[model samples]
Target: MSRAQIAPPAPSGPARSVPPPPSRPLPPPPVVGPSTRLVDLAAPEQPLSPHDPRSVGEYTLTGRLGSGGMGTVYLGHRAGTHGVVAIKVLAPHLLDDVDARTRFLREGQTLQKVTGDYTARVHGVGFDGSMPYIVMERLDGPSLHAFVAASGAVTDGEMLTRTAIALARALAALHADGITHRDLKPGNVLLTSAGPKVVDFGIARVVGQTHHTPAGNMVGTPGYMAPEQVTGNGALPATDVWAWACCVVFAARGDHLFDGDNILDIARRILDGPGAEAFGAVHRLSPRLVPVLRRATAQDASDRPRDGAALLRLLDRSGATSAVGHAGWDRLVGGGVR
Candidate 1:
């Protein structure tokens, strides 16, 4: 509930391990109060309107970054310092919902231990009056979702390969700390100058940790969620793998693997429909990677890569490493491998 934007339902199954696609930065969504828009990561910050809160505790709010069901995210600067941070303010109604607030705080705790180039570092946590808020490194980049919207699916073979590996590394770090990024999607991944950094840990959970979400209710985007998450069985490190595979395909094809007008349809297709049928078309694009993706998206979690680190190994062994290196990586973050 404290997660980033809710996405269309993803299908459940074992997906073969594959690389995720390259995406550009994301722009903020329309929400109540002062708003700002971004054309891309390099675009200047949109000035805050009169209705926007000037500050949230020690952070001086500068512009609206984005919003979702849980809260509004704003770009801010630390008072008297040049440090920039993205501020997420909890929704007013959820303030009274103990479970929501608890999860919000837990997200901070989960991310606090994760340190690396692949995640948005948690800077501070506090409240703006009755609203709980989180401060994070303000990345000068856009969400993969926005990038795809503007540039179409990433076509550079090397960029896609690098993105997949980077995200896999990020997930490996998260799982090492017992954190499951329950919601791993293009929109939740930000493409920055350094590389792709996973954002919005609002729905992340520790391995085997209990949750406040009701039983039988799904907790993640249907299109990107693992089978267990969709069926309410549970979330594991492999769950993120499944989502990562889906994202990879999306980035390559600029389309959803499972198509439907509603969640039920998507769920049914994932559970009962010919699973391979969905990926049939794209399978032709990169035949060699099909088997890897199949293993990652397998309906049975055991069939997939054990974790991000393992997935990276598979990619390396399978020759996905051919186009990856310092030069390729630079081209990846800089807009394509030459």
Candidate 2:
């Protein structure tokens, strides 16, 4: 006999009939519950749109990190490795423009040789048929622009000093390679777990290259842009320093160094006002930062710190000490700057 048929029953009730258990143990009570999907903390990018391309070159794109004037940036992993990479593909229409093609190719070639902890290392460049794309290591953090918007100003003195130092180091690395990052606004400074990594070199030019764009055509964000750049004097090491100072002020005060009702108004403020005017809202700021900002954002580029290395030396002389000790540097870097 089967076990079910041979099983014995419990003692009968004294004065009542007992109910028999249902055949075949009842399926565990239906699991009716709300959905509780766990989120992926590792992935910081947005989901790919239905129309987004699934693959680029040898990488399979899984998400869209962001889009820019030049092209779309997709998050993906190389076919053979689990490591994530950011694939920036030039817009299809730009492929027909000779200048655009030249600049896109030059950006990758320039970054290939420029490698350091302060830079987002370029992995490779290739063409998906007619469209060209550059592959770089993906950064798992927000841009300085996004961070400031969400966290307001970085009021901690130690944080401000650390950020300024990291950016200066990155700039020094770039200048060492004879490259001037034409676009050094807060949006291009990626604050990662490793520290600040300067990015977006599309408009960057070699130190001695002649300006090809028309004199009247201006580039870069006006508020943070150096006066020389707004007036079409062409980008130089000093231009980055000016923007860097503007960024420092913004991070410290939660306001743009030069603000106005419109782009023209902002441009006018940057062009017409002195760096001191931008510090009106920054009260109780450490006296040490005053001269640094003044010289970095001088109306005349010649009056500012000559280069990134010079800026560092100036900071050292100004008593802007590092926020953390040698061990603390690693701890702060691992946790990321505010």
Candidate 3:
């Protein structure tokens, strides 16, 4: 498959309604190359190496933002404009891996289709020669994981509720269109001035589908993968719901109930299925929210909230919604709420 990127058309209507699932047997996305320009960036913690390309298409590389398991993201600027964007280039190791390339391309395509207030926006996706990349809006904020690491775990109840609610709504948006963010975790949840914007859909697919991956290869982080994910049975929006509970708990305790141990052991424990009873230790904060999480992380996917829409209703009944204004949100990013 020729490496490609797709820029979803600008949103023309409300983003909450359901849409048809993306056509399968993937097609190449249109090549979208923005213009070039220079943007001064303070040196990143990890600067671009001599080997890194100075630009991809018309966007000039400014600095290295960061990298993930599958790609290196660079800060770039479009020509003749003051716009800054995040360029996510495919990791060199996976350049020849067809599955990895497919997943990367699918991620860009998924972002184009799944859009809402909490969904991360994609500018375009394309290949700079053989290198596939996705250009996305530059969200200037720390990830939920980074913020919790810098500060301690979230101790405030309202703030925790706000975080939980924001993530639930984001997931609901994806589930509305039958998309599942198979890799829902703290690192993928960017805490921006606009609240939480869900990013990285590298492993996302339609609910109840798993054939996208090579058999026996699990598609999610060990700690957050649902039971079916471990067995490679199938994926459901509930699979994301299970991971959602894990992220919320990470914010509250800065740890996972089934945390630590090796990946194999963690997967085994998750398969063993620990429910709400295991979360008794952290009940002090968000006592009501804990029960909701208990159900969200249920061992059986059927026992979970079903989808984001249903999950939102569960949160509402639990009073998880809160008036966590700017001040409360600021605390998560160290007074950096924009």
Candidate topping TM-score: 1
Q: By lDDT, who's the top model here?
A: 3
Q: Write the residue-wise lDDT of candidate 2 on 28-72 in tens digits.
A: 322212221111112235566666789998999987666644677
Local distance difference test scores for all models: 0.69, 0.68, 0.70
Runs in model 3 deviating more than 4 A are 1-45, 207-211, 275-277, 322-338
State the lDDT of candidate 1 residue by residue for 67-183, as single tens digits. 556666778887579767888787667999887898888877777878666887888788878878888877765666656665667666656667777788888888888888888
Tell me model 3's lDDT, rounded to 2 decimals: 0.70
lDDT (tens digit, per residue) of candidate 3 on 1-338: 11122111111111112222323332332221221101111112245677778899889997666654567788889889898888888888899999888888887888888758787689999998888999988775556775565555766777777888889999999988779887777767777767788877766786444544555566667777788887767577899999888888888887665654566677788888765466553477677787798898788889999998899899888766643455565454443221
Task: List the candidates' TM-scores in order.
Answer: 0.83, 0.81, 0.80
Local error of candidate 3 at 217, Å? 3.7
User: All candidates: CA RMSD in angstroms?
Assistant: 7.8, 19.9, 11.7
